[model samples]
Target: EADIYQTPRYLVIGTGKKITLECSQTMGHDKMYWYQQDPGMELHLIHYSYGVNSTEKGDLSSESTVSRIRTEHFPLTLESARPSHTSQYLCASTGETQYFGPGTRLLVL
Candidate 1:
């Protein structure tokens, strides 16, 4: 496999609820990334971390937050989800090469 996995491939929830998108990798990579994408649009890098205790915001605006406390796990959380937050969340980790998980599609109404 590609060494990356995301849980809850699809989600639909009402507005004003907390949600978390889980991302995990088995490659023991130090560089992890989370991207948001809409249908037929380019992926926007929202969050990234180089290593343990090293996190940085990417070149995009996002209401989500991520944690890289472990080398192979990066999870994103939204305090309160909204309709605007509906999008596809993709997680990736760089080994010798970059590998991306399938993704999680979330819909908030």
Candidate 2:
């Protein structure tokens, strides 16, 4: 199994609510990333960090925020969740290439 894990693999929230999706890895990889993808859709990079405290927001994650205070944990938050935010969030980390998390599917009504 992949060392990466995501909480509340599925979520449903009212519009304008707030939520945080957690991602953690036991692989000890310092490089972490977040991607937004819909079911059966192409994954788009949203946020990434080269190492702890080195986060960068990608083009697709303009509305989201990420912080990297620890090497094994990278959490992404949406302050005001909307229907447009409904999608799958995937977390990845590097070893030889990259390892992916199970993915969190969110739905906003």
Candidate 3:
């Protein structure tokens, strides 16, 4: 199995609800990243961190927020999800090559 994990591989939710997308890596890599993507499209960088207590916003604009207080856990949260928020969220680490999770596919109505 890959080093990362994302639960609720698929989700259907109504508008304006808080949601947290889980990302955990067992590889023990210090760097982690969060990306959003549309089906069969390119991945958009949204959030990333070099290590614990370190965080930075990526090139893309996103309503989601993320934290890296723990070495192996980096989760993304949306205070209020909208239809525009609907997309796939991918998590990766800073290795020679990124190891990605299956992704969390969310659909907001």
On TM-score, the candidate that comes out on top is: 1
TM-score result, candidate 3: 0.95
Every model's TM-score: 0.97, 0.95, 0.95
Q: List the pairs of residues colliding in candidate 1.
A: none
Give the worst 10-residue stretch by lDDT in candidate 2. 55-64
Which scores better on lDDT, 1 or 2?
Answer: 1
Q: Name the candidate, 1 or 3, with the larger TM-score value.
A: 1
Error of 1 at 82 (Å): 0.5
As a whole number from 0 to 100, the lDDT of residue 51 in candidate 3 is 95
Candidate 2 error regions (>4 Å): none
Q: Per-residue error at 27 for model 1, in Å?
A: 0.4
lDDT per residue (tens digit) for residues 15-88 in model 1: 99999899999888999999999988999999999999888999998999988888888999999999999999
Model 3: lowest-lDDT 10 consecutive positions: 1-10
lDDT of 2 by residue, 1-109 (tens): 6799999799999999989999999998989999999888899999999998899988774598999999999999999999999999999999787999999999999
